[model samples]
Target: MFLPPLNPQLGLRRQLKTIVFRIPTRESPQKPAPPMHDPASTWNTLKDILPGTDNTVATRVSENEKRVLNVFGAPHFALLPRPEPHRSPSPYEYFCTVNESASHVEQPRLSVTKLLTDAWCELQTFYDVFAGLPSARSARLSSGTRHHENLEKQAHPRVDARRVEKQIESAAQKHAPEAVEVLFGTPMAAQLASQWSEHVTMRLVEMADTCELREIHVHGFLDLARGSLVTDAAHVRAAVLVNGVVDLVRVDASNHTQREPWLEEGLLLVDLSCAIPRAKATMTALSKDHFVHVYDVKTRQNDTIPAQRSVLDAARRQCMFYSRFLADLARDSNYAYQSWLENGRRRRVEPDAPLGTGNATELLLRHFETLALDYLRLARGTDLGFDDFDNSHTHRQKQNVDGPEHASRYTLSDFVSAAQFREMLAALYGQDSPFLELDVTPLFSAWKRPLTLRYFAARAGQTCNILEAVVPGSVGVEYHNMHTRRLLKRMHFALDGATLTAAVQHAASFWNGTRLPTATDDMKRCVYCLYKNRCPVKNRATEKVGERIYRLCESQDGACENLHGA
Candidate 1:
């Protein structure tokens, strides 16, 4: 059950039309002049250069390959395998806060995807996050993925110079034009070519001015005439994970509004440890002072520029949510950064060392909020394993009581960290205070530190205009996104205080047996939505098996009718 918007539509019956009332007048096809196979015309040259159907597969490279090496960093071999966090299925219907004291209550898990989708339509998000339901992929979405994956293959440096010509031949055989929408779809493929032209034109202009002749690794699009590659998807791989999980952690920090510390203000995390190649070996420029490098090597795939712009705008809020998560983790636990030195030894870093990417080869404990005092204990917790424990808290308690291993590989720094973490958690969780105060120096270091998380959401920044570039990576120019930011500032990642009061209210109403209204906005998202069959807002729906078709009507007890895009 879901609640309707405060202001309902004036006439719902008038709007729910199965058939498109207005149709475009059809025009007869006219005979056109034959395409002049002239040298001056670009189309003629494109026909000659664009390879015919053959091998479409570009030579795919591994993560450790020479080209992507700089962007993704070196191969990470783990010291000890880490297990994933356990997750419980979330319910869409929000209930009264369960009294865990009387009986155990599970906290709802919220993600950036959930928050963003919830903003779109509460019911859809409820189905996604709460119901744990999976939706079938739409045709457009599948095509978009294919298109983006194609660009990724082309971005590899191996596809450069003489190799590119051979790759073109491969593409000709495998990537046929009419066979799939990804290869030569209008607007998407056309828009990609158009944007690629802009990048090549500007780069050529700059090259002419500087009289530069040195070879540089260019990206997705290539120049058939100059035998040069034009970079396209460099801006796309800012830093985000393919799956839903973003590196998440809790941090302690002062509230921007009240100027005081807060709990439940958790930070969302992104670990870009391998972004810069040489930086990791040197361990200096990589992670310097306040900033720690995070990498997400994902590509963009938006059809339009304005749509891409909108995605970049929405990402700021997501980044803010992540920053807040880090701040909360710092506040609640005794967290310190320890790095492995070049001399085959790990040492205690200052209050802010893990914040740096230097010597961070291990991606699992790459950088985490220490929930306890001593890191040695943290190591022991991992040694025992996660299978026995039901939850994070229970896992921590059992790790201590089970007796630490004597023949363990725990280091000196780990011992100190484990002790401090234990002490910190004891005092903080013991007494009930409006807000917990963390260690003086660490908290102070975090206070002055400007918290920020870098996002490379593939869908959003597919067409983000270039601001700065370092060959494989590009930065997007920031402009004020006031309207979107204002809306985002009101929401919190976790339910704390009044930040998520509105969200909880909606959930509570639904769980209380309130009938949730359909948020389907007419034809906007209804046509392609997987939930359309069950959705009330949809006036009509069609189901097909291969060539056969069956139309589903909204009116009760109505007979089936044959229709196409009605």
Candidate 2:
């Protein structure tokens, strides 16, 4: 017969002795001798003799003493349980809070990115937004950001410091000679002078016509009930504020090739001198207009070139959303004009308030002013005095050219006034209104056409393997290897109005609190997800812990066991 060991911590000799003495032989049943030392006392003695044992024992003793004192002295307080911590608000609630503060609306503001992310994996997006987790930084993201910044720099090139200083000196000589000393006497003064000119130069560039516009900001609201752009707040089932930046707006004069013969024929009989043309006179008004094409660039890792079906779908929706926003802004001339005027008026009244307090118009204006002031302060070492400029007049009065002696010093205030600035804004808005009307079509109509998605692969900080996808048009998606430049695979499809609408509505339902965020059906996505460890919906069967793997078993308690042991 076998006997199990009683005291696991005992020495082999001591355990054998205890066992031998306890087992009675076939001879006679005798009274058992007592143990030389109590098992508990022996364990206590061994614990005291071991290294670091005193510290551990002291800690345990102190904790026990404290517990005893608390029970005896303040039993009522010690027995009381802690109130449960306030539960964190859900993603939808957090969104509402942000919306109310920014736009003074209870409705949540959704971005093209957010909508796409929701479509990709609503559960992941929920954790991202609710927990406010910072996006994981990787080489691919950094490469893409650097590339975009380079592209934007091409549009608004830095002003030459030498040229700016020369202009400042010439202006000072003509108007205020003493002002030159104040401007160029110190390094701080000289720096500020350069910044002022740079700001003015950039503003001029923005007002002027450019063939390619990078990072054009756009925003508007979508009405869920009518499936149209929201204008008034009244009689709305629900409104979702959508905003996004157009990566690139290429002014293509070639769009005229797509113009129908009937459109051209109709335009020939209409009057050409009118400022605003009728709907039928689209071609005539568009004669001088250039078509604008929106492009969104996505950077991917080497393996992600031939993206999954879900990723491709998300990209298509993102581009469509951007195109739709641009079209809405372009088609509604009255709204755009009014928004510009209202924002400018508000900006004038409360110049100190933050940007993005109103619509995109206010956001743009405030951004310009803030940047201008920042540059000036960096150069001049002081706030460029806004009080120096006159705001009494609605328009700047033309001064006599002959009165050089009477001319004021060259300051940003003298270069542009509040009313003049507003006019410049109007002109900027006016330039694009006609072009957007002629080039952009409604979302439903535009979706019928094939949208292109370009995926760039980066290697050693350089981008290559430009894979382009013509959705709904091509049969398969084609991937190009970054190093070898070899074609990998092909795939393609197009979007329809109903499909796009359904996808958007499904995503909106989650945001509107109609349903909770659902986990992605694609198990592959969960493998690399940052929140997989904590996600309740994660596939526990495939969960890897150190060198071991586990699989969920169909037990009543829903327990998981090691695969090796199973």
Give the alpha-carbon lDDT of every model: 0.26, 0.38
Residue 201 in candidate 1, Cα distance off native in Å: 40
lDDT for each residue of candidate 2 in 1-566, tens digit (9 for 90 to 100): 56666665764433334434466567865545533423344435334333322222211223322332232253321221111222234344555563324432322456677666555677777655543343457876676676666666677654343443343334345445554443333332222222222322222223223334566555556554344556532422245556576665444454432322212222211111121122113323333544445566554445456346777777667766665555544443344323322222221322111111011122123233223222223123232222121221112234332244213232333223334334434444344432123211121121111110000000100100000110111112234343343444443334356666776676555555455667688767876665553454553321232123112233324333332223
Worst 10 residues of 1 by lDDT: 336-345
- Candidate 1 regions with alpha-carbon error over 4 angstroms: 1-108, 129-131, 134-303, 306-317, 330-400, 404-518, 540-566
Q: What ranges in model 2 sit over 4 Å off? A: 1-90, 96-108, 134-139, 155-212, 223-240, 255-292, 301-304, 338-495, 540-566
TM-score of every model versus the real structure: 0.26, 0.43
Question: Model 2 RMSD to the real structure?
Answer: 20.4
- Cα lDDT for residue 498, model 1? 40
Clashing residue pairs, backbone N/CA/C < 3 A, model 2: 191-379, 192-379, 192-380, 471-493, 472-493, 472-494, 476-490, 476-491, 477-490, 477-491
